[model samples]
Target: MGKILRAIKKIIPEPIFDFFSPVYHWILSLLAAVIYWFPSRRGRMKVIGVTGTSGKTTTVEFLYRIFTDAGFKTASLSGLWFRISDKSEPNLLKMTMPGRFRVHRFLYEAKKAGAEYVFIEVTSEGIKQYRHKFIKFYAAILTNLSEEHLEAHGGFENYRRAKGETRI
Candidate 1:
């Protein structure tokens, strides 16, 4: 599946792909929300987003413990792994951020499990690919800026802007 997808991507003109990327993601995000009923719609769960060049997974893990210890049910999505309340697992997707549907699905599970907070590790690449779409974040913590994902974002400044978008 991955191989085929990559081949298809390679066939598309870069400019055309770039132009449609946002629209593709936006439609999927919205479609996923509609099918799943947008778990964040009720406003009961607060998503705490963590984005940066490094240490995002660690930060999310730390915040998860804090929230859990403080008696709030916590869920988290990190590059290293993900957790739903007390349950946890390794991140098998390889992608630091999961795709549009998985994101909403995770939130649905969290909401169903009565999670009060979900801390996510946001990435510049993830944002560019629209993996950060649709979630209503209560707060965003930016650890720092670096020259990471420069090629993906086209330059350092663009990289920073992509990371910064998580705050919005």
Candidate 2:
């Protein structure tokens, strides 16, 4: 599946690819949620979405520490790592907010692993791509917003709007 998608990306023209990107992202997000049995909607854990141009990783790490210190089972997904309780691995993908399948699968795994809470470091790019669509967030934290990714987002207002959609 991955190879096929990669091939398609290689073949498509940039303009066409950009035009259909949103639809593709939305479909994948819905499909991923269905495949994962909509983990976030199952009420298995409190999913907190942290969004901002900066400070998202730091905030997620701090929350993870606080929750773990208090003896709560917690999972956190950040730019730096993917952690479930005491077990963790480096985020080699380099995507702060990965694709929909990854996000949904992570939530499903965290829930199955007995996580009481899950903290996800949300990014504007992720939201713009519909990666944050199906997840039902228990809470949302906006650390701060600034002019970042201006070209990719078209402008600061668009970036801010994307950040605003991190929850729900």
Candidate 3:
């Protein structure tokens, strides 16, 4: 555990780590609640999950724009930004996967923001880490598949299973 902590400290940017401190504990609490209560149930918010090697961000943005244009309160978490009900803020964490419980916290925030729809980009690593285990998605979009993350996935079939099988 000490070695892992030291490695994380060495790798993560100081500013990013500092920014996460306050929200980090709050997020953990939310994660615990979600795991304990709604482990297999979808919370009140309607979830839309987008996954693929590419276009996940674009698709999420497009959906967000559509929902905002339709005058419905919506929240979205993608590679580009974290949006809450027509208001968007940049995600400076610079992390593809923001820890195990960040998604649950994002959903909770969306609920507090009175969002009727929530959009998320589900990454392969997130799936592998069981980060997507608890949330239930109403719909999912797969843009395309490609030879990416071979080093992490070990093979193309495994990569595809990580990204594609989530739709099942």
State the C-alpha lDDT per candidate: 0.84, 0.92, 0.76
Model 2 scores a TM of 0.90
Whole-structure CA lDDT of model 3: 0.76
What lDDT tens digits, residue by residue, belong to model 1 across residues 25-112?
Answer: 7887788777778887676899988988988888998999998999999999987777998899899998778877888898899999
Please give the lDDT score at residue 133 for candidate 2. 88
Model 1 regions lying over 4 Å from their true place: none
Candidate 2 structure lDDT: 0.92
Model 1's alpha-carbon lDDT is: 0.84
What root-mean-square deviation over C-alphas does model 2 reach?
Answer: 2.2
Residue pairs in steric clash, candidate 2?
A: none
Candidates' RMSD to native? 1.7, 2.2, 7.6
> Compared with the true structure, what per-residue lDDT tens digits does model 3 show for residues 75-139?
89888899998678887877655555667777767887788888888888877656665577778
Angstrom error at residue 112, model 3: 1.5
lDDT of 2 by residue, 1-168 (tens): 679878888999888988998899899999999999999899669999999989999999999999999999999999999999999999999799888899999999999999999999989889898999899999999999888789989999888888888755
Residue 117, model 3, lDDT = 87
